[model samples]
Target: MLPFPSSSSSVMASSYPTRFCFNRECPDFNRHECYRPGWRLRNGDFADLCSRCASAYEQGKFCDIFHQRASGWRCCESCGKRIHCGCIVSASAFMLLDAGGIECLTCARKKVSVGPNFRPPPSFLYQSPIAEKFNDMSLDWSSSARSYRPPNLSGPSILQYNLHNRGDGYEFNQPTSRDKATAYSTEKQRGMNDLMGKLMSVNSNNHSSSILYNQKPGPNCKVPTCPNVNAYQPLISLKEGPLGTQRAFPVTTPIETNGHLGLDERYLWHKANSSPLSHLHNDLNSVAPLESKNLNFGIHLDTPGKYQVVPRYCPKVPYKNQVLQNLSNESVSVVTPLFEKILSVSDAGRVGRMVLPKKCAEAFLPQISQTDGVPLTVHDSTGKEWTFQFRFWFNNNSRMYFLEGVTPCIQSMQLQAGDTVIFSRVDPEKKLIMGFRKASVAQSSDQETGLNNNRESSTNGDAEPIDKHPPTEKKKSSMTTTRSKRQKVEKGDLSELKLTWEEAQGFILPPPNLTPSITTIEGIEFEEYEDAPVIGKPNTGLGSTYSANGRLSAEQDDEEAKDEAEGLLTSPKSTSKHPRHRNGCTCIVCIQSPSGASPKHGRRCSCTVCDTVRRRRETLLLRKKKQQIEIENKARKELESPNSDEELRQSANNSGTTSKNHEQRHAPPSKAQIDLNFQPERDEESLSPSNTTTKDKSPHHDETSCKPPSSSSVHSRHHHHKLHVDFADS
Candidate 1:
């Protein structure tokens, strides 16, 4: 009833046919009810069943629905198990095709012996051991070398042009399991082993037999029968006498000719061509062999080698620079300068040879061994390395070590005399490195000329005249009007003319060229105004005077005044009012108050400004009291141990006081005391006599006056007494 025939058609068309459910647990087992036209049949079994019956089958859902289709299925021959069609793609993958039949990879691996003709499983195609492929070929040097065969390019390729070509054999194509293992082995491979064994067994007794066997012509090789060919056939062959012994030729001229010789060519050739026992004469000769000619070498001025000794000299003599005298590294450095010798004419003439100074060799060169050469490397300024050996020879008579091999190094660096060479050993294992600083050619020439000129001048007794007052040539010409120039009479130098300001001003002269004119010149001017004022002119605008721009000048002055006022407020004398404080610009107290009156005017106002002033005054008074206390303490200390000057003054004061008391007690009485009564005013004078003496002892400049000490002195003494009169006064 379906467009496509049922999968059971192929099974039913066979002689033996029975429809059954492919599913194991189908209830209608082996019955036609579960076997629909769409049901698949495989291996004489129904692989597909009806959906209703399939539900009852145990593995109905899990079974491969396409297993019964021939195109979608394959059977692994060795295992007798069905494989998906895709899994059986290549004959080499999981299966092998043999003369017997196809076999799975597992069966093939177990039953098959891998040989030169064997094909590996597909998985092992890339994993085959490298050693196995060449196992049959000779690898040992003796055998492989003798039997090694090069690929024959003239031979036929795998692509057969003619039908007779057997290129499809295992050598080119994938070999089959039925192919003999020895089929891929070459004759050369088998012969190589036999040849190696023969060579190993070949001794004096059978050596000739082995040689003759190796030289035998093969079927594949063409015959060449010349005497030389027979002697050297198979590459290394020997010719022998009739008795099968090597024949040796007589000693002749040496092989290397033209005055150069070592081994004799004829002797070696004959020795190789004949057996060792073969000799031209049967009896050994009694005469000894002649000695070889002594080799003679030609002398060369310069050898063409990696390094050569071409004596050369510098173009100019070297000069010592501050680098040597002051360079810190030079002082303690083991690697120092070579020598101070100037490049001589002889040294300069030779191209590559540089004659180093003897001192240079001793100072810089390391201790020499018996070889007398120390390897050294010179690192140039550009960082290229040139290697050389510092060879030194001991001069027994001179007792000095002379350095050699410096010539090549110097030539390579292109060093001249003035170019200083410095050596250093930055690495212990590495050779000493040499660095050179080329002297400035121009500077050196200039120095030489200067020396010559100095010498010539000294000889000629010539001296350059020195001007005591060198005239100063002005670079910039100051431009001014004729009037200003005429008026530019030099003001007397302030340092030379010590005069008062008025006297100096009086000495200034009026410009004679000055003339009042209403007209002005039409010229470029720096000032914005048409009429620019002179230097110190009074600025009429804003009633401000200016030396330059009036506004800037006025602002600067205001700022300065403000700063002064602030300073005064914080100064020691806070009571002293600043001139700018009354200006109303900087008085914050007055600016914020109700009355806004200046505190400097001495007017009392019931405002916060007045209150602030009162508080400031109180603080000022307290500070003053602290300062006064400090001053009093300082004075007490001074009075305790007075200086010589103060002690003298105090002694004079004491003497004067005693003299006055004596005179008062004796007869001299003042007019007021005389009138009061002759009774001495001792009681009144006694009460404060100590205070008077103390006051007199205080520092006073005017000691010449008869008047009592000044108020300052009295006040000083008052503080001093207050300190001493402690608890009693309290």
Candidate 2:
């Protein structure tokens, strides 16, 4: 049975009913489960499910089950965070482990150093073999924010608190199936109807439910390819925005005066007085498992308003590291050094001002629109309950955990005028991340990636605060080192995370093709004759053209070559085209010479690439023929020679031929003619007196004794004789 509001007004009631849940309609609600004689149910006490879930909750009695979640607590043992639960935890598992002496599902352990200055809380009730919880509300959570050696705080969590801050309502909880269909109808009212097909995600729109990254989308999200992927980026300058400060794009005057947003002191104080509860959530492990039907309980601060709604089901994934990453959403929002101020006012009359959202005049599907489906207004209960949507915005909704201090200066560590924080929303709705943060440290390496290059002296906005104390040595539960474990916890499953709204910029509308009426190359720029002057040469200074990060600066490249450029338009003056002049024709010698007068004989005018290819092919073919004939002759000699058997045996030893065998196999023969008289065939013209052999000597490089052309300059004629002679000689 789920816990319900006590007959008492306050959520944290001391005495709870034993037998049954107060909500009579609930099917599983127990009636007389914990009927202790001394039970006193009150309005301020936690009311239902006390008697239903446990008499004593012994070991293994549905121990791994997760129950609903709650908010508003104190410091983490690893990271200095104040929240109800440290991170995502399993209720059933916590109970089971408590009985088994292992309280933390996360594989971590700690030892607190007892100093006179270091005092344990007076009401130290929560403790397990792994983690000890603080019961006293007076304990300053900020002091424990890792200031000591081996700072006793949980590492950064992967939880995100419900910024909507509604209690037990759709404003804070995930939406139900009924809510989704209802939201379907209102989809027509949105500005982006093109994006409003049937969008669905694993998680509903609410902060109470923790979500891990899931690879699927909601049932209604559009299926079009991302419009931002392949197209030219919007010509907006990455450098020209409001630098070193974090302010959204609605213009306003400088600080001190009541700014254009009208964020005055009156509104700030009213918010503090309104909600008695400081709602909190974690992103790291606070996510509820998807299959489990556990309800997550966060402080829905709108006690005076109408009923808020949240999703009926939220799934949990692991945590993620934030310092080194950003969601691949629409143009990644550059982290401004100064955090932007966003205020969530549920009561329009109470705040007394209207926020003017610039009409989404342009077309880029950023998550936020003028409507309520965005983080500014998530219908906690799966979009079913429309009126009870939770409104969220960036720094406007900060959990107590985000306020950890550099103690001794705890009082001085209030959020000042120029503080900023960046956040990513993961909404698979399967897991309930209470509030998790990935620790990030600033480094020069970030500069090379073109990430946050415009950031100034105060870089903390661009970088997340790293864990002040990284754990040393191995943890007991097969957990990696502290940093690695924390990193894994923070980087939740992304496959499950789907964009509720997206406008992809990658697609480019193709241009229509047209046939040319005339063909010409008159305005081209290539050759430089006497009539035309050479303009720009390729610059050899690779360094000035690029940064160390390998990003070539197109602007710099253009500046260096500006003198040589020409344009057909009047704006950019066109330069004279390189002149193409004809040269007079010459004889074969002139053509063959470097002057290139005649194409017939000039090497310069010939197709050098084709000539090289033909020569290579001819050489390869000749080599193949010669090798084949040598093999045949060698085989025949082995069959006839008397010494062949002994030679073969000797060659077989040593796993190869000996020097003598190699000499016989590869040696060129000396010219041998034993008879004084030569028998001459008609083919052997040199031997016939009637046909005399004439030798003409020409001086040439020893290496390049190209075949004596058949007395012709043609390449084909020179190789033909070589081929015929080799074949005949063989």
Candidate 3:
């Protein structure tokens, strides 16, 4: 097949002509080489694999994404995620992982990320059936089977032992060197057979086929943490057995817990032995957590490892429309040039930013904030370094910075009141800064950037430096506003506005123009009585308190989180069975018109009216446009079909050349008959329009050559009217 390419021949044909493989899964096909086909050789028997693989072999190199390395297999952990985006459509992306599989920044804490070299070994929690299987297997973590890399896992017991033994460095029992040499091949071949047998046996039970891989061992490996394992045990934690711990390693096999029962009974022609991913039999069963959606989500991101944690793809804050409403560069003194309201993380979420203690490198920080643009001095919990040059992640968003480190940065990172914040190691490779969080005894600015939510919003991991904050001179209103300005701000900025992504929810989304639709909320208008007592009622917290737009100021809203939380404002008690709100409207803002939505103004809804209306209008318009185009095209075709003598000649010529055999089978019409059929043009007057009469006089069809004007308005108008509907039905 390779021209029997000997080492000499291969050396001679060093630039061996390349060949392409059509199969996407072929190890030989390189994404780069596929884009270039001319250099691709097409020797029918040149090579079995694609040119890329051949080239790689010829050059002695391999793709980092697929080749086995010191770390582990690079195959997808979310193998079952090969499922298309929706039932009807496929997505452009596949579930890919980074180099250190299962490495992901914690969405709740910017500083806490999991991956090799980034976070420490992960843990797991065990549940029922998995625990039962685990109970049958050995549970040692300090042995060589775990501490060192394992050999091939061939048979069921061997594979189970390997799986339970290896996912997190748990070693399996290996034979002595002489014994290994004597039995390695036979045992390995036997193991390979066992691998095949186990793979085949999958789906025969509740276990899925993807998890039945070149597996190691023990059913407990599938469960993140086993309930049977004691929680306080330092060696194996049963409760917190998340991917962050060693328990996440599949002791037995990778389990597909996302509910795709590894069976393909849909097709009559599909073979019993066929697999969806590849002919090479390895199970990629779901190992996602049963409770958390993200723990084992099937988003195919191209990270480096076999166990890449799915990055959370939540709806973004509506940043495109998010205007910095409060600040404009007006004439102000230099004391504090009206610090522009760049961006703020209102609650426990962190903004990613970077700080340099020494040489500059990108740091992936979360819990961002708009600190003073000064290099921050940091000291590590180890009391190692001072003025911590930390990195924070930003949306690459704006120059203004804000950070709210709600949770500490590291598992080893802890804080206590009166302790000093410090910097430790700066992981440039992972774009992270490690340090200690110190607590405050005195009330620092009461407002804090909520750093509890550690979300990663940066698209490309091109790290950024955080404009340093001067920690010593703390501004009174740095968290929210410059405590001085009571001048008010835009109403929209008052509340934490969230955007919804219809794509994630499997709903077709509207364009950027989409905003919360207007809903009219009917306000109760009251008539004042003439003989009423002049005693003013206790303000009722309504008419006198409302702004012109009937919306509260940002200050009032801020008070709601603090004041109402303190039981200062008790929730109104409901009296009726169907509990009517005092204002008759079920909404919080009584003055709002029922038709306009309160969501755009910070209120939740109990209706789906707007979405339905929008979908209907969109569908109607799309249908209308499609119909209009079809009609116009049809009219143009009609206008060109052999309408004149020359057109007739051209048509006849084309028809003649089209099929000589058909002309002979069905005898051609007689000259007289054809002449009569088109005799309507015989009358010179009828053959030409009034405007073309002069050109038609010579019978040369002189008007035929001129281009038709786009301004055929009369005809266009007639065509348009005939094609399009004038109005939409309500």
Candidate 4:
């Protein structure tokens, strides 16, 4: 507990030190010594008032600060006295409007006692039936009875209205206040017993404990000598059991303290009367024991928040390899080892010898002749067969049988120490099937390197410090050596072909030997010419086709050219020996004509074949030109208008007009000179459908007149061209 300050102490002298004056209008609010003197001395409490307020209090003039100001304290609306807001008893004390003013804590309680909804506290009803009877007989057993006073009810119910409704701004009806003296006297006369009786009677039927509190002694009571005990019927039993069964049941009468229930008494009574919850309690004896298999699944993962339990351990995963069968059928007579053995270093190192186990030799080699060496074949892991000479030998010292000559097979499989090797006899005449698994690093590398390392370590034992190097460096060096050796073998296998001169050039004779020097003839045999005068034979009148050197002369060449042009001889340029062809040119000479006659040489030979070819070429050129024109026209039309109704109509008309123009252009003509200029103009103008329609009408009107003039003009023009051509040639 905090120590209480004496009246003379500075704390009591100025409780609210350095605090502002309660009155806003006070001039001493900001001063250091603003506390009113002697006020605390008289009341044994610190004062909130300043010197000016104290002076006003002495002059019999009320300062508005006392009534209007709230200094952690408020003025009671009825008494006009300052009361601490924290000291308020209930919510009803402060929930007041300014016109109704604030009711003091004391007034608020008095008003609550007389309110319509107010009910007497549970402690007031906790009086034992014996105590109530004694009170009715006017016999007080305790000093509390004499000091007890009735609750005040005569005061106006100003603060009694519902405070909850005030938050919503609703008004409540209130009774008018009476004169102070009369109100006090009338309130003192109202007893608490009358109120308690009314509350008890009203709630008796609704509560289960009412009968207990209200029970009276019956005629058969054993405690009749004690009036209090007889009146309460202490020996009486209820349905479940006697009231004496409750521990400390006689002391259950509740005592009120600041409106709080007697919690200890109430709890004790409730514990004694309450029944245990039978359904909710678990029976520990019936629980099953934890199982091992289920415990594996119950283990949770170490990860946070996830809390996922591990799956059950499964042994089937590792044993799944047992399902695989041997290479040969089980029905056949075979030697199949149930388990493979790891090859040792001494066994794998030799390339020309092998030692077989006694069991393998006895099972597979029993029929072999003792004196003869047997040729055996063994297949490796990849199914590649290797032939080796095998012979069984019995050691005279050990008296053990062993098979030999597996070196080739072991070398082919590249077995090393710690590598597992298995053998199965698929066929007696064929090869023994062999399979192998690569050695684990720890087993192979450690065993092989340990020997080499030991030797090197022994050699350098005194040369270097023990901590000079680490084992990792030795391992790296060994690995690099192995890698280099492997790389060399790989390079040899994968390297490009190496070529020699004989193989690449496909000849073996030396360059100088192939070109031997030619030796000159020692003498020429000369025939003695007869001295008789040689007379030239009379010249045959035929022109020499070639000179003495086997070449044509200029005159002979000219004759050949002329003959070729005439289609009477073939030219030298023509490779074919046909007499009609010259310089690869196709003419009547080269092509067979329809008439079956020999062709005459000319640039413009009028043979049936030539004429037909010429006509076809002309028709092809015309058709190509027409197609090009149609493409250009279609592109132009598309550019001028997109696909629309007008374009469609225009296209339809253009198609019809184009057909009519084609018919007119190819129609049979009169035997007259055709108007070439007019024909070209008409063709060019047909691209525009609007213009073609206008030109088409004109053609229809002039058809009759135009034909006669065209015929006359054609005849005159042909006669003039023939006269001019004849004059120039002559």
Counting clashing residue pairs in each candidate, in order, gives 10, 136, 117, 1
The digit string of per-residue lDDT tens for model 4 on 206-312 reads 22332233222222222221111111111111112111111111111111112111111111111112111110011100111111122111111000001000100
lDDT of 1 by residue, 1-730 (tens): 1011122432342222333443333445445443432222111122334455444322322223422332222344567444321211121223322111234345545443432223221112211122122223223312221221111100010001111111122112221222211221233223323332332232223222222222221122222211111111111122332223221111111111111011111112222232221321211110110111110000000001001111111101121111122165333111111222333222322343344543333223332333344454555434557654555455563324333456665666554433344443221112234554333222222222011223221233331111111112221122211221111110001011222323222222111122212211132111121111111101111111001110111122444433332332222222112211122222322134222222333457665444444543443344346445654555576677677555444333322222332212111112221211001122122124242222222121122321221111011111111111100000
RMSD of each: 47.2, 30.6, 31.3, 51.5
Which order, best to worst by TM-score?
A: 2, 3, 4, 1
User: Which model is ahead, 2 or 3, in terms of TM-score?
Assistant: 2
Model 1 quality (TM-score): 0.15
Q: Rate the local accuracy (lDDT) of all candidates.
A: 0.25, 0.20, 0.20, 0.26
TM-score of each: 0.15, 0.21, 0.18, 0.16
For lDDT, the strongest prediction is 4
RMSD of 4: 51.5
Model 4 regions lying over 4 Å from their true place: 1-339, 397-403, 427-431, 441-730
Instruction: Summing lDDT over every window of 10 consecutive residues in candidate 3, give the lowest-scoring window.
Output: 229-238
lDDT of 2 at 560: 22
Error of 2 at 503 (Å): 44
Instruction: Give the alpha carbon lDDT tens digit for every residue of 255-331 in model 2.
Output: 11121111111111111111111121111111111110112111111010111101000101011211222357422
lDDT of 4: 0.26
Q: Over 4 Å off in model 3, which ranges?
A: 1-306, 313-431, 434-548, 551-730
